[model samples]
Target: MSKSGITVNDLLKFSFISDPQVSPDGNWVVFVKRTIHKQKDYQSSLYVMNIQTRELIPFTQGDNRDTSPRWSPDGKTILFTSNRSGTNQIWKISFHGGEAQQVTFFKNGASQPVWSPDGRSILCTTSLKENQSIEETESDAKASKEQEKEPEPYITTRLKYKANGQGLLEEKFSQLVFIDLETGEKTQLTEGSYHHNNAAFSPDGKRVAFSANRSEDPDFTMISDIYELDLNSKILTKLTNSEGMYTAPNYSHDGKKLSILGHNMEYKGATLTRVWTLDLHSKELICLTGDWDTEVNDVAINDLATGAGSPGAVWTANDDGLYVLASERGNTHLYHIGLDQRITTVAGGKRQIYAFGLDQHRRQAVIGVSDPQIPCDLYHVSLDSRKETRLTEANQHWLLDKQVSLPDEINFTARDGLSLQGWLMKPVDFEEGKKYPLIVEIHGGPHMMYSNSFMHEFQVFAEKGYGVLFMNPRGSHGYGQEFVDAVRGDYGGKDYEDIMDAVDYVVEKFNWVDHERLGVTGGSYGGFMTNWIVGHTHRFKAAATQRSISNWFSFYGVSDIGYFFTEWELKTDKLDEPDKLWKHSPIRYVNEVETPLLIIHGEEDHRCPIEQGEQMYVALKHQHKPVKFVRFPESDHELSRSGKPKLRIDRLNEMAEWFEEYL
Candidate 1:
């Protein structure tokens, strides 16, 4: 594995694995691993394993960040979420282990816990202020810490007032609380100014389900319904009336069904979340993956690991079926479905599972996955012989010595006759009439894809000799929902000829590539398609673009999803289309940019907002073209997936020194 190759210092020697769980009589599993330290930051912890003497252990240690775990329906405890007592709360411990016990002291702390099928209560989620409560935000943080008071002015009237990595706009709101494990008592449970989010609880623990938005202009409607409540008659109930976007929910273990995860914002935010269910005695509902056109979870993006939330579907202990995880085309798998709707798969291939758990008699589960040469771990599958096993090697001895690459899975045809999908790699030291230098990259959820994940910047651009590629062009998401709703109102049209027919079908089918030593990159909507491909094709020769947008008319008022993602991706109506958002602005094709670009961004990006890379570096340096920009500081739009590890290794050495100074 290591004949040298894969460096950004092998991404601080990789160690990822994420969330897994599986422990309610499936004999232990837990999970979350993370790593990266001496390059300063990112630690995470909590482990466990056992699943029949495959023993492992560690369950929470130093460097803070422990995460979501759960279990306890008499599996003898385990709850989780930690910030080691400095903030993010909820603790618990015990499945044959010792000391842990914190469990919520709330002054805006506490998080996702759940456990209540008669385990004497605990539901969680915190954030407060708007009609203030959690004991008046813990007595106004103990009277602003006994009086040094000066910093107070943030009063913005919400229409989504700020939020990228949660900055500014804090009239608070995250809600839901509960607690009581035999008299410790806490109880807030739903307040106002919106946001309730993924709560769960019902296999008869007297109700709790969640997901909120409660209309009356929740920032001009991105809907989000599904309610429930009733923890002894504080009654709430609204189980989705619909304009779309519900969320995680859960229930059905004989409580007669609920299961949620959502969509129906037709294609707003490129829709596809699917898997519905409801039926709690005919309050009806249905969508069980309405014709399953992929994406029921995991949108494969990977810079080593952060994913571990969606444990969505999971039902089958005779709830008549559902295991879920979907994605498709670029593989995410683990399927099942059935109460006669059928589906199937269970476990998958071509890798990238990203997270999973499931026990109390759903046989065996755990998962996490990854591929294109591993960087994610935790496995143990077996739900009736689907096999798997390898429970955690968190980056096996720094990926057994290195030289990685592995990609080649193409498929082309787009000069509008659609059918895309890409991936290429090839260049870590290959020979036989050599040529090389190609790059191409692009992927930032033009509905997210470039699948079979585990990308570390396409393996450090195939260890610098280049040849990368990467596609899924037509608004991605493993295709279908009319190809992820065909790039909403056609951003840079035909997703820029489906990524220039995937770089002209890999330079007319790869003859060791070269094609004038091209290059190109991407970030948010692949940095607005690498600033709409160096302002509409000067055919590559270097370009970068990260966290970009370049003016959907000043990104429809400075982006945090810029006022409804500029009226749902420029279908206009931002007050009757400012000339159709300056005709899909890449700053109106910056005087047709010629190439050597680079831009990058992030100064705390409010989702593609470093003023959309300072309006494409001031419209390509006021048209004298050849750009440069950079930015970063405290970063955002997840500066290349979870920033700061030496600014993600100095943003991959500033995109490998701007493509080694112009391709």
Candidate 2:
């Protein structure tokens, strides 16, 4: 009998492991495991593994969500954030295994726990108002209900007031504070309205380094600077000259140097994230990857590892250099970037490694990895010997009897002689020569790349005898900065041609792909391209646009990041050249659409607000064109990735049904 094929339902059966934390003693690793609960919601828990024997140990199996597991200095305890106590709070569980004890009871909740070097206290982040501190007691649930009954109106006068995930922003800022493990004493370290985040404690524990936009008129320039806070002297010194969006400040083993990551937005939204180093003694900051073209951060886009941690620079065992994530071509690799201006691939392959944690000695590491055939799993790596050991089979149980389609890498030249890369996935059971319907998958970001990561949606399509094509066209990050920025100001010009050329290349090279049965779908930026594609040509038989942008005119003020993003991506200001945005908007040429279209949108999506979907659906319908609108209530732009379990299934079902009906 043939093995079962991957279905949308299998999404609930798969376990997603992320944020691996290596124990200080280098004997074990801990990570968060997320899975669908009762097919209705997601439940995240903690699990530990012994490096020597690879024995899996279940720690927290409760119904509540647990995440961000961090090892204590002595390796006798584990600190994690969970909603087991009704709200997210820090909890500590002993290594011997017993009931976990609540360590923090902050009213605003806490996360990103960092233990002091001496292990006498712990520092964590929590949202706080200008006048508040971490010592504030947890708000009463009953009082919370009372306040909800009379929700306060949002009042803001700042450009950076709103965020996509958090919704209409408040005056609350993320602050770091210390908690005495013995007395539960709380001490606040950051203040003010601007966020003070990405903090790291010094080796001697006398100073704390963090990034914040504590500059004058922070809402305007919006540049964050690195600062060192003296715990005893209560003096704060700015370390960076506010040159870029520098963040994730990590001190060296000797605490004489700091490594940071971020870009100058020098190329606007398409600027590749680069690594930087700072000498604390001389106060000299050096751009480590200034001459390099590689992106110094994980830009892989996938739904498999939701809430996965993106670790910054990990110090080497000798502290002479650092291990950082670098994205090149189409994969996320661990690269060793040294102060001596040398960069080499450490742990790299045709796979996506989302998160990793190094031992206290920086010897071994535990990484979360996944590819087209693998959902998500943890692997242990020996830095000295370059040996990688699979620590867990998180989804192998379900995958063992399932038919997972692996993709074939494709490289083709665009019409402009630009080299483009993508992948082509054949149907689950392929024949020598058989025509199959093709579905072109587009990724969002326009800056983020569709890597060799596992996508459940693509697997579902492949299982249904449909060939899937996903490519990293111009404006995609894995390529160099020039290619990524090529789409700016030329939005629908070359980027659209790059995608169309890929489809043409596949149609000519792979005769199995039925040219007559071409369909296309994408979310966010991909969604925008879908709208533009269908409007521009009648080549695609059908198209599904999710969380798309139909009108850049309205997008200016409506989107959470619209005010600035519109200027950055389109290279046009709403006031100076409003028509330029409209010229590039997909909706401007809606009358040219001839393909049967499906519109999928999340009501709560703030990035490419639901209005974009409504406009596309209504415009096509008004012109008496083929179109259907599918709206997901209480869902956001992340609906397809980390939305409610049932809603995610419903989304896949809708798209599948649409393709089956049209293709």
Candidate 3:
């Protein structure tokens, strides 16, 4: 059995599984296994498992992380992106397992390889522009050789003001590259001064579909036009010209129509990614799904190759317009899409739906699922019979005696009578009517959702004898578009009240919560909220704000995704609306803070810079408040999940210690 209460070492050894890729034949699945290394920071590798035999094998093993595995047309080869070659590049290997071969060689890097339908080529995106190199000039060198040459302007100009992961003004562009499988030659497809991504090949091998924000929409970074490429003529044609962003294009097996995901102004800040199909001949666009709230996570069309009893996804040669897609209906699940665009629930529940595959007959499908107890396992499901067959015993034995807590869904009404939803995990050894210290766990994204799935942090709190409360307040994503937009321009208003009411509800009704000895913590936007909460109210005795945003002014320029996100959430552009930004800033209300705040931040976090924490620490110390700052050297914004193993463990230990001392 695992040790009780999270330890520094336990945090270091934790690993995560993501990006599960199922092969076309429905025989194997490959996925990325991420592990944190205390010394080096992050480590990951690719692993493969046979669906029929239930045999698992490690594909690539090294110090560097390998991810984004894509299967070739014949299913005999696998292509993945890796940093083993000193930079991220496409690497290929046979399904039989042997020495992996590097596919692309460039000065910068390339990733996300997708195969062409004919198996003759592959498509990958590369951001090749490098930062200008400053050559050191020596005084002793020949001065005459450098004479009479006019200096070129070093200034770079681009209309794009904000980016998702890279904040501030972005002047660079990413282009698509097509690589020949047989000759090993490569050709750059799209060029000029705009970013293009998410390329998909047409089923007939004649054209390719991609999303791009070209010279058409220079200022609006969110407006992406779908383009179709005639592979033979090297000509590009516009498919959908709109004022919103469109991505993840997929071609029907017959190549007569195209389906893509799009988000317009009506979606607000969240992605109401609905499936839209375009007719190639008529140039008419058809909106298939009416519900904009139901986001289509991943999509695939049914083909003749689907297995028996499978949902007959329109992927193979079968003329049936069937497809299998995944969506977040409470939890992630695979759904069967009929010819008329009707959706039927395929497989999903409290446990996560990682990935799925269907054989030729479309009668059965293979699913990858996991929970708090089971890491991830492959299961065979008959779409017709609805029978599930467990194929892998990967974590069966290890989870046999695991002492994990089942979180109970709890709801409470805020002061404004708005219904707030959340989950609470009692101690693993829960006692009846026992008053225990509480830990209010907050989620980041301010836009991201905290689902019913198993979380390591919640388990750690349960083992530490603290009642963990995590909720989906007004700003969470999965609760529809209106709820997500509620926090926009109104930070700390209703959202804070909802959280406060949640704590009050638990304290008043549970009788087990020691209201006076409560602690609060969260990261990213959640960290921002934590800082905001401790400043506005001192209901909790202690607080741990990890990767928090204490100041909105600095955050607008410092964070990678802040340039637009800041304006989007605060409802104002920087320099243009200073007062509005100040009104939403937590630092503005720091004068009312009484609770002890322990700040945990990463040294190299580009999302929320370290200075945010430093300034908060300085302000608190200057005011003579009980505050402490802990910095993890050389870690990014994902420090809690992907930081250095040892440092992450240290972070959790420090947080627990802070609450242990004050709460």
lDDT of 1 by residue, 1-663 (tens): 438678886777777777778877788888778787766888888888788888887877888888888888888888888878667889898878889988787777878888898788788889887767676444456566889878877777666788889877777788989888778888888887888978888887888888898888788887899888778888897977868987887887887788887877877888888888888667888887787778888887777755867878878888887888878789887788886778888888998787888888898887888888776777788889988888667777766777888998988788757677788889788786888888888888678787887888888888878888888877788887888877888888888887888888889878889889889888888888788878788878888888878778777777777777777766775588678778888878788888878888878888777877886787778878788888989988886777888888898899999898888
Provide C-alpha RMSD values for all models, in order: 22.7, 1.4, 6.4
Residue-by-residue lDDT tens digits, candidate 3, 1-663: 553543345444445555556677777778777666545566778888886787889898988878888778778898999988777888999988789998877545687688888778999987644341112112212353448778664453443443323444435568888989899778888777677887888877778888888755556466788899998999899888766777767677778877666667564566555667778899887766655456555311110001111121234345434454444423556765544767777786665565666654466676766554555556788778888888665544544556777777787788887777877878777789778899998888776666655566777778878889888788776556677789888888888888888998888888878888899999988899999999888788999998989888988876766677788888886689899888888988888899999999887788888899998899999999999989887677777765556676688789878888987
Model 2 lDDT tens row, 1-663 = 887579988888988888888999999989888888888888989988899999888999879999988888899999999998878999999989889999988888888888888888888999988887565657654366567465567788887777777788778888888888998788888888777888889989999999899887787765778999999988999998876788888989898998988877788777888888889999988888888888888889888754365667867766788889888889988888988879987788898888888998878888778788877788888888889988889888768999889999999999989899999999998887789999999999989989899999999999998999999989998888898899999888999999999999999999898999999999999999999999899999999999998899998888988888888899987798988988999999998999999999998899999999898888889989989999998898899888998899999999999999999
Please, what is the TM-score per model?
A: 0.34, 0.98, 0.87
Summing lDDT over every window of 10 consecutive residues in candidate 1, give the lowest-scoring window.
135-144
Query: What is the lDDT for 611 in model 1?
Result: 77
Q: For model 2, name the residue pairs that clash.
A: none
Q: Which ten residues in a row have the lowest lDDT in candidate 2?
A: 139-148
Winning model by lDDT: 2
lDDT ranking from best to worst? 2, 1, 3
Clashes counted in candidate 1 amount to 7
